[model samples]
Target: MHKSYVGRRRKNPARIEMQEGNETPTRDQIESVVSLYNGGELDAAHAATTELIEKFPAASILHNIRGAVNARKGNHEGAAKDFQNAIDTNPAFPDAYNNLGVALKKLGRQQEAIENYRRAVSIKPDYAEAYFNMANALRDLGRQEDAVSNYKQTLRIAPKHNGARNNLGVLLNKLQRYEEAVSQFSAVLLANPNFADAYNNLGLALKNIGREEEALASFAKATEVKPDYAEAHYNKGSYLFDLGRRQEAEASYAEALRLKPDFAEAFRSLGAVKRYEKDDPQIPYIKSLLDRNDISDNDRMHLNYALGKVSEDLGQHREAFTHYQNANFLRKKFLNYTPDLERRLFRMVRESFEDVERIKNIYRAPAEPFRKTPIFVVGMPRSGTSLTEHILASHSQIYGAGELTTFGMAVNSVWSGGEVTAEQLQTIREKYLADMNRRDVAEPFITDKMHLNYRWIGFICMALPGAKIVHIKRRSIASCWSIFKYYFSDFGNGYAYDLDDLGEYYASYMDLMKFWEERFPGAIYNFSYESLTENQEEETRKLLDYLGLDLEQSCIDFHETKRAVATISSMQVRRKLYKGSSEEWRKYENFLKPLIARLGED
Candidate 1:
């Protein structure tokens, strides 16, 4: 009889575990309820659980099972209440607490869910499930570092925790720890062997670090693992797009949208693909989605922005500007509107007055110290840096090194280390120059267009004493508005989130420019984007003459050059120079009233 009972118990682990724990209602009772709930007999499960609860009023197990069923039916508040009842009846039931936390987290109560997770972990120190739930709560709260620690702890207790590992990788990637993230995602594949999202993310991480081939292999593997994975198709398309494989890229984008009709990212990519001549097919869909009550305001805002791009491409500049303005306005209503960044901007007139004496001390005419020179274009994004670069790049003897990360890397090494020997500095300077030596593009002079290099102008001058810097400037409202409307994949432009933050950043830029002008006179040149577009020929000639490059027809036919452009303005630069967008901010006068007041008063 004992042996028969033992065999029967081995066949039902949940029953034995529940019996051992002395919980009311059998494990069989809960399993029966779960089966009914999953098999569309949810009403039966509710009736069974209610009867069990009446027989044993403090039956936490019945309450927990009922809560899971309620969660399935989208009754989040009901599930939360039932889970709370379970915890209240049996305070030591860790699984019930975890379930309650999940329900609360689904409702976006991150802080409260975290408290429940903490309680579950406290009651059951080895509760790996609770740890995972805690990590999720922390991630929802935007406390990513804390979430990572919790996730790592879960995996430490259960090495085969694929879900935890994959989530950890996603968080690390968002934090820009690409290599570390790659390792975690790879480990998840090793454990689960079929995680498509993990494989897709691994590809992105590898690509970010310049391992393009391996990234492509990972993405291919993701599609192989799950042919229906729209994200993998999108990933493949974006990669192909970057590689300049137009046909294959478009096909991939189309495939992704076919698999998932509401894939907005895919729509954005389609718009980008057709942007050269404005062959957009996604605008109609976006327009239809713009008035969707089911979608978010934020989604609608991005849709408007997409419609704006379509109009902009179709030569409807005014309509495009209006849509972009609306998008920026709608996006501002979000909580993370914008954050502060430490980029420098130039304000010349007051800077001249304040730095009059300092400039007198620092200013000295160049003695023609070096026959060879490289001009550095330093400024904010969309601040005429690219235009300045294209003009110089068109020069007969100058090469355009578009957006070189070298100078910033060197300066970061200096700042992060806080000390550098003369030999070290010389090595860095050589690296900077060697960076300009691209494949078959040798020239007497090159343009180092590290836009953010404006902050490190002092270090830049110290390293290359003969280098000339062009600080590209744009109007404050226009620049901030442009940034806000631009969606970013990285963290550098946090000011895109908020109007106040944009204003604060503009103020910071002004201060830095003032400091640099005082500290390094004649080291930086200012070229406002507005002014440059207004007087293109004169500015082009003046800029080229400064670099000692003689005038050439190539400079005039800059738009005709078929050079590779990686910036978002790549397609726009391929056309003739025009002043179509000279007064883009005028239409948004009502929207910018506050911003204008702020800038005007200052």
Candidate 2:
């Protein structure tokens, strides 16, 4: 949400000349008009500038000032015209070009806006504001890497530009460069101590890096600095919820909703933490927001999900299905998603791993030296991966590194397609182990619960022979329904939005797992999620026995473990194991025929 700083006000305007025999305006005349504009009297400034422009039609400074006034008055068309006039009179005016770009951006002409910003920066390479403006436009256009470059350029020209630094950090966070994002946000706080958004963003990056305490403190500080910051409150709630502080998290979400009643995210988060009664007041309040014409599709989407949860809890299955349908439809439209992208990746992975003996031969070499063995928990999302990881992490000998993307990154960097070379396997192993070793945990093992890593089972087996891989299986219908009902922050789960896509994706995943299991027999440990839930102690003993570890009491009492869980199952895992979760989907069976058909009654 970086704003474009149009340009600084012109202080000295005595250099301009009038036509022959015409009197030039005094300094007082120009300053008076600027004073009106600076004082927020946009109408008076516009009127005064018009009078002065009539007298000195070639006065570039007057046109620029009037453009600023027009922009303040929400007359971007007039502002654009005035800025163009200023550029016409003084062709080398960087400020006029930059200001015109801002107007063009407001008018939804991003390409034209970028052209004006380019002209401004070309005239004066040190124009940090113009560079920052160009970055904003580039970001809006989804050219994130280009935006990062320009933001860096702005910071280079103006080191103290908090906006550019903060925006750069936000992009970095989105890119999953959390450590780098933390550095940027920390630097922003040093420069602007009172920056609440920076603190909120800092909290996000810190949380991503597993600095839970510091992250919570940063979020609290953001709310302390700006009590009216609804977004910060929402973020604080999310963090608190991740830490299993349900009561505090509820209070924070309530505060956020109180501050900004239309905050749809807050409503959804509040819904997540609550077990609604039939007569809950939040139902009517959330429904009222839907009736507002000003509500955006994004807001409406979240609200629908919130309502869906409430309906489901109230035993209104049909109503819940309707809400989920609306939410998924809007989400699909917003994402403009197609399942082909993921299906193609799945196909490529299968093709690459078809030569199983080659993979084994290439990866048979000794793995990187590690004090702690790496355990990978791979499965479809919402399929008990988080629960399994939490259970394992509760063991004294194991630590849970929730959903690390290091393995995928390493594989993507070194292995393209077809047979992976021994050298590439070594590279991936080193990269992944290097990242893991940085955590420096004292435990004998650590779990990586990136569920989508099911595609990389073959790679994991080859690269890290010491690593233990656990594949959790759940009922396909239960998994798909759970996935469809929840909003995944990661866009990789785009297939979850459509029933056919989800079913097809799940089929591919199952096929890939089967191939991996066949290619590398005895390398993978397969377990059923339902069996684990139904027979907790017996299944726990078997799982631990496979990993050559004793089943500790903590593993059985995983619910009592005091660690942060950052998934939709966070709350569920905090409670003792329960059955009937697989049966909850049956309530909406009539509405889920499409999904049922795709999954074949599984």
Candidate 3:
């Protein structure tokens, strides 16, 4: 949130130093005001600049100096007017325009600020500060790609611009370009080793790329550098929570809340790990936040979700439903979910593989066996995909590779209108296996528990014939209810926020799985979650047999297996199996009539 070129120590102050015109004020008179401004005597600088401006009314430097003083003093409105006056005196003044942009941006006029920044950069193309300011404005206006271009331009002009680099890294992370983000952050930290934000951003990017241990170290470094960084603490807590370190996660969250008491996301994350009792103090605090009008919809959404979690734990089913309903209602505003578009995509997927014989013909086994094989645990969200992966990964020779996007990236690379050529199929196979081979795991089998990989079963069969696909099944009501009640960090699960959308999406998923089953009978191992809970030994034996592996005692002792699980079910998978989860939805059955009706046939 640093302003454009304010506190930077640079030689040759082009923006502040006035030219010696024939009729302008003397150099000594100008220096008197500029010296006060530069010396941090804002009151003296403002008073002296205003007095001199009256004598030399055409002096743009006097106005610019006054604007800089006002900006430093936090009077953006006055600073903007002063910068405007400077621009009027000298219309080609890029500095004044840039300064005006900063002032206007502080006043919440991002579009106008961007316009001023554009004008400044146009007047003087080498104005790196203007470009940096424009990039910040573009990000505020939600023009992320444009912001990135401007940020790159700023760095190109001023390679030592750590602020621009740090912001660019953050924006890249938001765009999910994690590796590029890591590079930017790393470069920033190389020059400025004490840059806390860079360390924090690097941690985020590393986490996204499955470098959890490195990410944790980066987060720790960020906190060590900046002790009061609440967001860093919150992020560390989230990573810990995903790793099933509930106590440590809770402690981190507590530190974050201590630093920033109104941190709604931290509260929501704390609620995720905390099992609430009747008199939990956090309950009233979260409820109090809901009554405050100043809170944002995003904050309100998190607060409501947190309240919902605590209420549900306390058996206040109806109250929890109300909070969840409100939370989802707020959440839906930020998501773009079109049922028809989803339906069309599903239809195309079905049509692409409609020629079952052609699809089967294209399927080819590798010339040599892969030293490492993948076990894809695919299914709907909250349908025990994580649990299945945890169980399978408990084996001595299997490792859990959580929710990898390598296959999806390969699919998107060469997939043309849902069709794939034989060469393209090979390319997909090579790309996917190349990524897998690059992984550091020594295990012969790795479990990829990216639940939505259910969508690409046909491609998986063709490209990775050696891969085992396990389709974990749960009762429809239980699964949909589980999805709707909780929040998914991934935006792809947009359908979960609405009951009707959830039902329709589930129905399509079931239908697609049926089509796959019809085409590739006996290919997918359909594991029943309920059955696994009821008869753990028999069902697990069947699962292991499908993968051609001998039953291990560790599989039965899955709860005791130690590994990092980064799913919502991270905590759940660490405990012993229990039945009756499917029946929990019955408590909210009356309120879920719409969902039930939509899922009637399922």
Best by lDDT: 3
Q: How many clashing pairs per prediction, in order? A: 5, 0, 0
TM-score of each: 0.67, 0.83, 0.77
Better of 1 and 3 by TM-score: 3
lDDT of 3 by residue, 1-602 (tens): 01011113233222564677755789999888888887889899899889888898888888888888898888989999999998998999899999899899989999999999899989999999999889988987878889999999999999999888888988887765677899999999999898887888888778767788999999899889999988888888888877788899999899999999999888888888889998888788888899999999989998988998998999999999999989988888877666887787788778888886786676675777876899999999888999999999899989888788778767767874565568778888998888778777789998888888888898898778768999999999999989888887766888888888788899999999999998778789999999998999999999999998999999999989877777789899889999898888999988998888888833
Candidate 2 residue lDDT tens string, 1-602: 11111222233311222122234356788888878887878789889999999998887888888888888888889989999998998898898999999999999999999999999999999999889889989988977778999999999999988888988888887766788899999998998788888888999888877898898899889889888988887887888888789999999899989999888878888888888998888889999998889999989999999999999898888899899889988888888999878877877888887887876655675744666788999899888999999999999999998988788878988877767788888898888878887775889899999887888887887888868989999998898899989987765777877777788888888888888888888988887899998899999999999889999999999999988898888898899988889887888888889779877884
Write one digit per residue (lDDT tens) for candidate 1, span 1-602: 00000000011101101321454777787677767866867678888878888877687888887787777778889889989998898898887888888888888888888998899889988888788878877976778779999999998888887778888887776655677899998898887677777888888777655577897898899889899888888887777665555677789889998998777657666666666344445666677777678977756766776777788677676677678767767666554543421322233323333433443344433344534466888766766677678777877688775766667665554444323345545656766666554324557787777677776665566667778888888877777666655655444566655566667766776777778787777777777677767777787777777666677888877877645454556555666677745456666566667777766633
Ranking by TM-score: 2, 3, 1
What's model 3's lDDT at 598? 86
The reply for model 3, stretches above 4 Å from the true place, is: 1-158, 164-186, 205-217, 356-366, 416-418
- Judging by TM-score against the true structure, name the best candidate: 2
* lDDT for position 327 in model 3: 90
Task: Evaluate all candidate structures by whole-model CA lDDT and list the values in order.
Answer: 0.69, 0.84, 0.85
Q: What TM-score would candidate 1 get against the native?
A: 0.67
lDDT for 321 in candidate 1 is: 66
Model 1 stretches astray by more than 4 angstroms: 1-23, 26-31, 38-40, 241-248, 276-285, 291-294, 336-379, 384-472, 475-481, 489-508, 511-602
In candidate 3, which residue pairs get closer than 3 Å at backbone N, Cα or C atoms, i.e. clash? none
